[model samples]
Every structure is written in C-alpha cells, then in structure tokens.
Target: MEPVEINAGAYYLRQLRADRKLDDRPALMEAFADPRHRRYVLNYRLRTPDEATEYVTLRAAQWACDERCSWAVADLATGRLLGEVGLRDLDLDFGTAEASVWTHPAERGKGIAAAGLSAAIQFGFARLGLHEIAYRHDESNTASEVVARRAGFTRVGPEERPSPSGETLIRWVLKPS
Candidate 1:
C-alpha cells in the first residue's frame, strides 16, 4: 500500500502527513480530545503536541505497506480534518480486510464516515483487487452500524465474545459488485 488519497464527496481522504507535524497537531488534538472518541476509538485523549505527534507517527507507519491503510477525511475547502477511515488487518492472500471509521465530534451526523468508508471500499475492491471487506464495530456503537449499512455492507451477525470495549461485536461484510 502506497498510501492513496481519495476524493470523497464533501471531503477528501489523505494519509496524515508525517511532515505536516505543525498542521497535524491541533487537528489531531481536536480530533481525539473528545470523550466520545476516546471511548470508542482510542483509550487516550490526545492532549498535547507530543501526543498528537506520536499518533501521526504511528498512522504514518501504517502506510508504505500491504498490511493496512489509514486516511484522514478532510474538508474540501478548508482542508480541516473531518474524521478518519481505514482498512486494517489486510490479507492479500484472502483478499480480505477489516474496515474502521471515526468522525470528528463537530462533524458527526453529516455522513462523514459513510462517505469515507465507501471510497475506501472502492479502493479495496477496485484498486487492490480485494474480494471482500469486513466491517466490525462495537455493538453499542449504533453510528457505526448506520455507516456500514449506508455503505451497503450486509449484516453478518454478532460475535459471541465482546469487543475490547466490553460491548458485543457486531459484524458486517461487503463484497465487490
């Protein structure tokens, strides 16, 4: 994976630039600071530039590989980050990966996750020649379920075990058309 950028309708998906440290600090801090984000996406809230920089470094490393790809969904006009969507646990042999998404607190309810996830699915099936993409999220996260459905993923039932978040894991799958 060479870290592709995508033109989502109201937003674009780009890898969070490792070189854009100054630009990414405030955006990441703002993105991960919310309680909602910490609860569902990550355990720690990005409070300082150093923390945000560390996160950027981690996400940057996820690129330049075949294993995973992550993108920052940004506003078209302002270029502010609206959220993130990614394919993780990629297995080319099986042409499969798990999709994940998170929206900025201020940008919630505007369909950001759905748009970003849809574009990533297209890239997976069309560009990467993947056969299927699996989407799994904490069952308590109704918003993720909505995004999966909106992006045309079929409900594949729930896992018997709970996710790390202590909620049952609901599963969905999207196959290439």
Candidate 2:
C-alpha cells in the first residue's frame, strides 16, 4: 500500500519517513526522552539523538511492511510536529489494531492529541476497513485517558501488562463503533 495521510483541519497526519533522518529529530528526541512520557510508549527510553534515530528506522521499516503506521501530526500552517498518532499490532484478518498518541509538552492542551487520534481512527476504520480499533494507555496517564475520551474511545476496563520499567502496567482500551 502507499503511504497514507489524514487531513483534519488544524493538523494533518502523514507517514513517518523512515528512509531519511528526520529534520525534527532534536524536538522529537526531547519529547521522547522526557522521563514522564517514556514509559507510556512501546519503544525503549530514548536518551539520545542516536536512540531516536534508531526508533525512526524501526518505525520506517514497520510502515514499509504495513505492520504498523506511525503518523506525524503537524500544524497545518507551519508544519511543526505537534505529536504522533499510530496503529500498532495490526491484524488485517481480524480488522483490528491498537491506537496510540502522544503530544509535545507544549501542544498538550491545544487539542492536538484528540484531533490527531480522531483522524487516525477514521483512517483505520474508514480507509483501512478495520472493524474495531482499540486504544491502550497506562492507568496513571490521565492525559491519555482524556485524549482517548475526547477522541471518542470508550473504556473497556483495565488490563495488566509488563512495562519496560518492570512494573505491572494498567492498560485500558477504546473500541470504535
């Protein structure tokens, strides 16, 4: 499949270009390296630009193989990366995937995550023909919870999973109707 882009008014979502080094690497690295946000994502803690580059490489490969999608959420005017929204653990046969989103610290309260995630959900169900799209977030992540709710996700209760930090993570899901 070709790379996908989702337009959503104030911001747009596009496939993460893995073949080239990201021009926004420094900002992205700073966002991912923030200890407060690191545990909520699937990747290891990004402590340096090199680690972030490795992440971009991995995400690029995943996008190329259609195993996952990592979309950059950019401002419509300046094209600044506000954050990212993606689908992971995609199972085409089952028409399901897990959705995740993260916003830059400066972009948190401006509706970036909710809007980006809403666009991603639309892409998953409408474009990708998915029957169900779920979202999972750590229990302590109230911000994620808010984003999920604002993005129209309903809570399916708590689930226990292992985290990179070795703690039993409490996760919740939101499925699209």
Superposed Cα deviation of residue 47, candidate 1 (Å): 2.5
Error of 2 at 10 (Å): 0.6
Model 1 regions more than 4 Å off: 18-22, 43-45
Q: Which tens-of-lDDT digit does each residue in 27-110 have in candidate 1?
A: 778878788788787555579988887877777777766778899998888677888899988888999999989988888999
Which one wins on lDDT? 1
TM-score of each: 0.93, 0.87
Q: Give the TM-score of candidate 1.
A: 0.93
Window of ten residues with lowest summed lDDT in model 1: 16-25
Give the whole-model CA lDDT for all candidates, comma-separated: 0.85, 0.77
- Model 2, 1-177: lDDT tens digits are 566878987898875543443355666877887767776665666677777678767778888787888888988775677898898888888988988889987777899999998988888888788888777766777898898888887787766665555644445455557
User: Model 1: how far is 70 from its true place, Å?
Assistant: 0.7
